[model samples]
Target chain A: MSVLLSPERVEIQLGERSYPILIGNGLLGEPRHFDAAPAAASALIVSNTTVAPLYARALRDTLAGRFQAVHMLELPDGEAHKDWQTLNLIFDALLRHGCDRKTVLFALGGGVVGDMVGFAAASYMRGVPFVQVPTTLLAQVDSSVGGKTAINHPLGKNMIGAFYQPRLVMCDLATLSTLPARELSAGLAEIIKYGPIYDMAFFDWIEANIDALMARDPAALAHAVRRSCEIKAAVVGQDERETGLRAILNFGHTFGHAIESGLGYGEWLHGEAVGCGMVLAARLSQRLGGVDEAFVQRLSALVERAGLPVVAPALGLERYLELMRIDKKSEAGEIRFVVIDQPGSAAMRSAPDTMVREVLAQGCAS
Target chain B: MSVLLSPERVEIQLGERSYPILIGNGLLGEPRHFDAAPAAASALIVSNTTVAPLYARALRDTLAGRFQAVHMLELPDGEAHKDWQTLNLIFDALLRHGCDRKTVLFALGGGVVGDMVGFAAASYMRGVPFVQVPTTLLAQVDSSVGGKTAINHPLGKNMIGAFYQPRLVMCDLATLSTLPARELSAGLAEIIKYGPIYDMAFFDWIEANIDALMARDPAALAHAVRRSCEIKAAVVGQDERETGLRAILNFGHTFGHAIESGLGYGEWLHGEAVGCGMVLAARLSQRLGGVDEAFVQRLSALVERAGLPVVAPALGLERYLELMRIDKKSEAGEIRFVVIDQPGSAAMRSAPDTMVREVLAQGCAS
Candidate 1:
């Protein structure tokens, strides 16, 4: 199944900060995949307890030929550990090892690992080169491609971070073979996200290949990852800083963030909350007359089919509003949401409380 | 003294990230000084316990006319407090007050406050617009002008940070009147730094007016800050990230950082350490034949007259080497020093341990 698809590359054109996203099977073990990494005396692979045991060794071995020394540091798994303490662990390891400005960092695993490592690289000695070796479908499709790196603060998600770009992003599809079933579905949430916000053709393809993707068919997953990266690369290339068009990428993130913060980080996988949040955002789009009932229902059905929750937790309307107000996107206490102006189109807008309440009342469980 | 000098502006050109350094007497109370700050609903003035009582209110009052709401958060004073624990306070205040990405931050103190606030603004929601309101002489001439912002780690000084720029830098000369005599001397260390590294004319000016600068003469202080900023701005504009040419600005910082880290931070103010470090670097420069012994002695005498210690701390040879290997300027365990090529020029070079040892032996108190 792996031999059925060839490797693909997506370029994120950020001028001097530009790099490529390499996607294929078994790319993690191929030293040639990392040929573009900056020449340095040392390389450090930063992963988590779970993924390190699975893929860190392969990455270190591949990098050994290029660097004089290759080291590995595993952080505790999950979003709960994505704080200053865990981030400092990476710094401590680098300083302890006497890593210098030229040292390259490789982020292995899911979104949590990618974000933290990208941030650690961004911050360690001001800035250092880093490569992303994303193992999960969610990261391979979304987080790994973009250079947005951050750690979660107790008050808000990704409250502290930098717009630091990575030297390379390696999405080895083979690693997805070890991903948990629940996690695969969470990744699908982000893949499904691209369809509603930008491309209906991609959405149609996902709806048709949902079963093949669920079964972990290599060709179907390859196309999914490739298309997702292409779309993301295009959006990010245009609005790398999220000053305007980039906010559309957060289509479901306002509601998604509230749920994650309300339930506490790590309670629900980020993709899972985003999946449900997309449904709520689609519903709000209908209330704003940007989309029809059919489109909202269609997105909800797809979200549910992806094995994500369509119904949000009953955190109460006031609590939800409070959480969203503090989201990084909000300004002057107004919660800015990414609403679908139409299928395959999105815009950042603020909905009135009465209308938002109606969407919440209908989306949340009683 | 206050009316002797008119407001002056030095432009730091870095393309879109370029901003001005405003220098004058009583600039903090003038609302017109901050006209260039981004329009936002709210602003946060991050200061220290010592500086807040003195000028936070005046700055806040000036900002009130622009921003709908203005708030203040004061952290403990000194270099000892420049850590993650202190950095998080700014984040906590921003999130707790529901400050968004558009919210402006004004750093209202010396190097410690400016570095922390700039870092908080850089990391808060990826990045935010911030203004530097440097109060101390050192900050006004150095830290505030450059976009280098970070907190000290247990392992190293500024080992974690970002090259995030500010929208404006305000240097109110009036604030220096209240500065302690020792701190004022520390600021002179940085003002003196510009002479050997970039401009010998500036160095000559400092040598001649050292007494007037100590007396808090507004005209003398204003000229010192304006020239120092102009030199820094020109250097920073050419190499904002310290990739090559920018590193020359750390003419004495390599030795200064080791001294600070060896004795523990806050034991010696950054400028004071640099004052002494410059003497040691000058001696090393003489050994390397970059400068002559007569030049080194002349610089050392000026440092002493400015009330800064010309002799280095007795941290021993090995301790200094170990501390210096971890300095940010060092690459791959090899210590890089910014040696004076001549009286008016500097270069980043690596000297032998034997040479460094001899210089340390002569410079440090036995």
Candidate 2:
């Protein structure tokens, strides 16, 4: 249990609101994430179907010992429920439990649960504090780190979210044990993004350790999770709102979100969509002369070795263009992809159709 | 024409990223708000049905003339429409317009429009720059001043939103001419809030000039707008998120939001609800020993003079308690109100039902 918790404090530097993200295991049962939260008039833990069976009791056990009062609100699982209705469940729970201003929401799930919970926290009382117990590889490595909490809009995935930094992000790496392999690989999509967009050296490391990383080897996984959070924490610190520099972190998200939205929620795993999206983004970058073909090959090789989707579906080039247009990355009609100008540097660029069609073709190729 | 078209600059002192709020006569016809905007490749204006008919064309003409290209998306109006559907209208406009990362949005209307448009801009393309052109007095003074933008959720008012600061806010006071009396009165509720929460002198000024403000006296209106923006700027500058000192600004908002939710949206104008809400909050403050009964009488006079509803309806104490419990401000069953300790000073206090019921009776009394 001691070894499960990290001594290193993961800092989310959002001015006065900045707080330490404790990345570890058994910490859910520890006093930090739940019990140690400032004693409020009341507290409520918001979780989802999937993660509750695994960690809710442990959270309650830890928190129950500390406070005279506590309540839990369990929500239905998956991206489909990440809407206003799902968010209302938290309100229903709070009202039922009689929780008030000092209520602390404990998000006990992957990205979807974390997002809805965090969003409920943000809007619950204009705002309230929430602890992120990211129970997925993607959330641990990415979503739970940056404090970008949101629920999906019908027209778009994650279209209605906020740039709310979290009071705490607890990445219990051990939770990945319950995650499906596809999800594990999807999380790697973001892990891969970290390399091409910010750190070429990290990309090389990920490439070298692809097998171990994919196998969820504890050492490789920890190294990846810790480094990913550090990179995200650093980027978020520099630009908390994804204005300019932080947009680069969405290297493949522009194309990825489109795929998620186009295919419909839960149709494609977010990381899977991102994985295919990175390939398209890399090809488009090469087409734009921002990134050379070799870098594209190197990135593609890592994605393939990690058992992630390297090829997008054969949704016609026109359809791909249409889908990408609806993406969050697009402003008006231009499709902007976070493309690598070079290894360790990324830029947001609008890829016009012919070249985009070519990239889409390449991405769809087996 | 150049000088007449120019927007008056109100500098909100934040940092390098902070931009000026433009106040003038016909800025919609000129490129003033966009001229100083960070040079983007394109511009997108998020306007609602009512606003688009009157101002969107002028805004588009200016932006289209200034930027390489510009686009306008007209969303439906009213607080009820401020949801995922309305937000997507912005997404549709952005995508259909081919806007890219460099796109900036101009929000044109009152709080509903500003909030929805701002939230749309905040999430679109991960994040984007937006300028506020708040037409109503409430928006000019309150919503348009601090960049607290959000969209409302059906379960709760403003349950989905972010604390996304705007690049600039343009308040064309002339737009208030078209504002309905109810809308104007709603906006006035926010204007009056500034006096009790942070500016006593302003409170005295408001009390003295309530008639002028109701009559839409230009000088009085402008003075109220500028002062509220200043007070808001100072508070938001210190605490952008309502974590500590900022929560004081919620003086009547907690009670008001509950009323908005409990009564069902569209049933009550936000300002009218808040106007009555502040009376209850003041009474609660009196009960809590934070302020004297004199504070209650003095504030009630201004509220009544503004032609706003000074008495809350008989929601039934149980129903009132239930409604307040679902408020974004409530957590464990305790309903907290931002009560005045004295003029220009406010603090949050959670009261028991006996006191809240007593206040409810007084609040609902005809």
Candidate 3:
């Protein structure tokens, strides 16, 4: 039987714009994989320098039959390059090649490429259709599923962006095989988050399969990605703009963003910052009596075991506070963090500055 | 009687995000006029240097009752300043002030200020509430009513933007009294467009009262703005993202955008370029047998009477063709023009290259 016959599909129902997330081994070679996207006269595949050599040619070849012309743009790699200057490169390519509003953009790399391409599609001629073919584990389980597209600002992370959905999100399990060990651990940080914040049972599953995930087991990775997507889809569907419950999905993002912005973008892998941030947020939860101290300890151990940072960098407590104050969740300069109420529940609330400072002072390197 | 008590209100319905446009002689000074905006602790008034000195103080004082703090960001004036670098200035003020997601942005200038501020609000912290306090006739009638917000790219006009709606649109007619003669005439160009594309009766009304509008008669300006808004509201309500009916709204914009892009943005006031483009389009419409040549001459005469351009710029035909091809309406390298079917209806179509060249050669002033 052909690999196309039975690939697992995850449906993200967003009214008329609903699309599917196709997951399976060797799915990139299957033409049927792009079924959700409408056929356009031209297709532009945006990838990074690192990932282009690995997968862009095969993806382009697969798209050749459907599109009259296929174009490829290889941007410099890393989160540091995710800004307006780099975003302009995609627009320059699209316009130079005479691509029109109906053109479809295929993002063929990690979160940075997916995000910038999605934003380019969203703003190009007001809006256009784009497909997310995320290759990183963090993206497959997290960023690629939701319609949140953005680029970082000098002062903040994902500061400039739009809530633009993708035509489809294609996650090929085979691509993760080529990911670096450090990058793989970063993806695990996000995978580990869904359990404590949305589903405790999934959290337990992650704890049990952490070894297999690290070892790159196909079955284990598939289960983690699908479960994470389901939780994200349900959250995003209810609150597409993060006006309410959707903010819960940024479980460790408040602290993680501070670390990322403080250290400068790309210094710590996004997942690494988030991993350490989750620990800080859990401690804040314990301090607020929302979760037990033991809950914080258990979560930190998992992050460490996954080879991610359990402790944040030694940015002073005042620096951390300054960075966190400007977060989107902050209201009138008051920071609101997503804290765990229990093993599987999360909500946003402001903590005392003293308590937060204590968490920062004591939360490092543990 | 207070001007706010008898202000004409037009509701732009877009489901839950609908907002009202208030048109009156001096609505800015009335505290009760901003009742529609959600109460926020902080408000930022984004105005240009030209407009800020004139009205920022009054708007700030009006907002002071509802908001705890009101800040002003005075951007440099002109379409030349509408780029990413200038847009960054708004971001700098927002971040420096530690403004939160709930902080409202009040766009208090013409099309340039309003468009940039709306986009800044849309992208800042994913999205934020904004109010369009358009002070120019051009912005009051066209740019502010619809949720189309963007900044120009070196390669195109309004290329980078989003369809983000505002909380309220306040068009204080008294402010237009300060507009330059050339600027007032530019505004008339857009006001003239509403008639040919959507309402022939309004077209006749404009023809009859062209002198009254030019004289800045409050009654005449009020009727023209109100009717133009009603038609724009209807079009935008039916199609917010320009997927279909909304393209009709860009009646002369395809060619107008070409001139704006080809001349380098800000060289011609947007409405000036559009006035000339309307004549070219009307001529093209007659050439294609969509309308009669007499209709073209009559429209051209009215444009001239409004102190606007009737003949196209002497940009080479090839240059015009090259510029028009990248417009938002173009598809698969085909340039789509919004041609008149009669005096009051418009649709998009591509004309033969030779006929377009002929129109250009005979249509330009030189």
Candidate 4:
């Protein structure tokens, strides 16, 4: 069965590893999501408890029609469960079920589920084919699109991971209907990010259409996802390994990740942390003369209006610094921040401890 | 200081991931071995307890001259310890040392150390540069050059892994002098493999120089390693991902992995298992009419002469079948064996269960 909405497709070109991102409503029912996926003898659907009951059966049925055997592995939901122990569950299930390298894995959940499954597939049999059926807004626009598969370490976010590309990314917007309002707001943080980092026009659109998106208007959600993925696809196509250009896509992530790790992962939703992170990043950018105070305020106002935190969490200046220094972007002991040069532009740069502290103090309630 | 024999370099070209394999004695002390390595702030020499006391100090001294921080993570030696827990030690040390992505890891042991360190580099910060200073004949000739890094699972050997290539592979013949005779014999199992699978001439050379290799002649070891790496480099360059041509390189691995898993990892050194596995594969080839029994007997004689197990352990047919089916090469429960079409040639094809059973019955002592 095909979805009603004409699926907007964005191709992430990395030569032989290039894959298509299919964004559409009611895509769970669409058989075409499995079209580009390699015809495997068996398919394993990896979803969390929160997502399995809603979409696992339909996904299994769709996959079953194509594969000889379809197995569903339900993981405990939440970012805290995204570790090696939980990843082992997928490996255990795959091995028990006699799944081979040809066995395809379908990641059918939010960012946490997608990231864990992608990593599981990446390591299983030294790498296997996986299809990302992203159910949450955070996954569709960011994590699932970029091929950055990882499991978080206690010391850092996405510490143990791989640059494994997926065979196909199916973003079924219909699944977002079951999403909590908090999660929807969290996803908007990433959505709001593309505007300041790559395209100011898209930022303008997100500002104008925030309400419509919060309302879960299918058209608005589809357009936002499509545009965000397009920008991500373009950036990822240029730098799949995050050597240079890809760091810009992490516009607010350096600070965002610090906030996430400092407060403990899943304490704040990844997007929520990133949303707050964008505010701090904007302030830091302004302090560095990349942008003005007015621009920072404008972005902060939008983040707040999106129902995300405009103010940073009091993770403490030193603790945040400690966490940020360990971030993948940090070279030597110097912490690199992906600061916005201006609207529609961002680059990774290091700032002095005093200036970073000044922004943290100004942005946090403490 | 440079050694007596000039080091020969073999380049395994995989476009951007292409790296050098330096084969010579006393090369580890020479700084030229690391000339191509990315100049990093720190270097973590990931060796083991056995290798550490013997060579870590010298390697550390050599690396310390170049890198500001030269840290060593000494793990428990042996294949039994090559699991996620031991790998975590490397991760923990890197994090504790404030090692960043620029931190180059040196796998300074045999196959186990090289595989673990390479996998660590592959996962750490998504990807980092690693140098393989393989100290065993098996590793120097095969595992070190190909970039097939992995840790074993309870169900299979090398089950959990990644195809992460190293920046450089340094084979110091001096280290092999300390290798136990049994360990040396195990390495010869892999060295003898090159002839039957890829080069008949190399096979003839191995038959001719078996005594020279076993006697620990430096020139003999260097020549064997250089030729083995050349065959491996040619194979790996043609098929980096092991989709087609690379599978042939695992001429005996399908059966060999089963033997290792059945006997339990470390019970039989990897090369010993492969030596017996090559005999089984040869017998299977004869059964499939791919080769004559003479080829099987000839290979088995050489394996026995080299002090490797020519007869397989009685793992029982059912258990062997169970283990072999889960191998990465097996497709859809059809156990694909890399059979010798003739000496110096191999092809992956599935044999019938009955034929496989017969081969097992003939090969196993039971």
The most accurate candidate by TM-score is 1
Misplaced by over 4 Å in model 1 are A4-6
Give per-residue CA lDDT, model 2, range B1-366, as digits (tens): 123344456677777557677666666665645566767777877777787788778777777766787777777778888887777778777755656656788888888888888777777745677888787887887787666777765556666566777887878877887889988888888889888888888888888888888898877777777778778878877877677787787777766776777777878888888898898899998888877888899888888888888888766778777777666665455566788887778987788889888888877854
The prediction achieving the highest lDDT against the true structure is 1
Q: Which scores better on DockQ, 3 or 4?
A: 4
* Model 4 lDDT per residue over B1-366, tens place: 236567788999999999998888888887767897889999899999999999998898888778999998899999999898999899999999999999999999999999999999999999999999988888888889888999987777787889999999999999998999998998999888888888999999889999988998888888899898999999999999899999988988889999999988989999999999999999999988877978888899999999999889999999999999999888889899998887788899999999999999999987
For model 3 chain A, give the 10-residue run with minimal summed lDDT: A1-10
Can you tell me the CAPRI class of model 3? high
DockQ of each: 0.89, 0.35, 0.81, 0.86
Q: Per model, how many backbone clashes are there? A: 0, 22, 0, 0
lDDT of each: 0.92, 0.77, 0.90, 0.90
The chain A TM-scores for the candidates, taken one by one, are 0.99, 0.95, 0.98, 0.98
Quote the lDDT for B327 in model 4. 92
lDDT of 3 by residue, B1-366 (tens): 124347898999899889999999899999999999888889999999999999999999999999999999999999999999999999889988888888899999999999999899988877889999999999999999889999888788888888999999999999998999999999999999998899999999999999999999998999899998999999999988788888888888878988888888888889999999999999889998888988988899999999998778888999999999888788888889999987799988899889889988988868
TM-score for each model: 0.99, 0.84, 0.98, 0.98
lDDT of 1 at A28: 85
- In model 3, what lDDT does residue B73 have? 95
* True lDDT of residue A339, candidate 3: 95
**Number of the top candidate by DockQ?**
1
Tens-digit lDDT track of model 4 for A213-273: 9999888998899999999999999999999999988878888898888787889999998
lDDT string for model 1 (B1-366, tens) is 556345899999999998988899888888888898999999999999999999998888889999999999999999999999999999999999999999999999999999999999999999999999999999999999889999989999999999999999989999998899999999999889889998998888888999999999888998999999999998998899999888988978889999999999989989889999999999999998988988998999999999999888999999999999988888878999999998888999999998999999999998
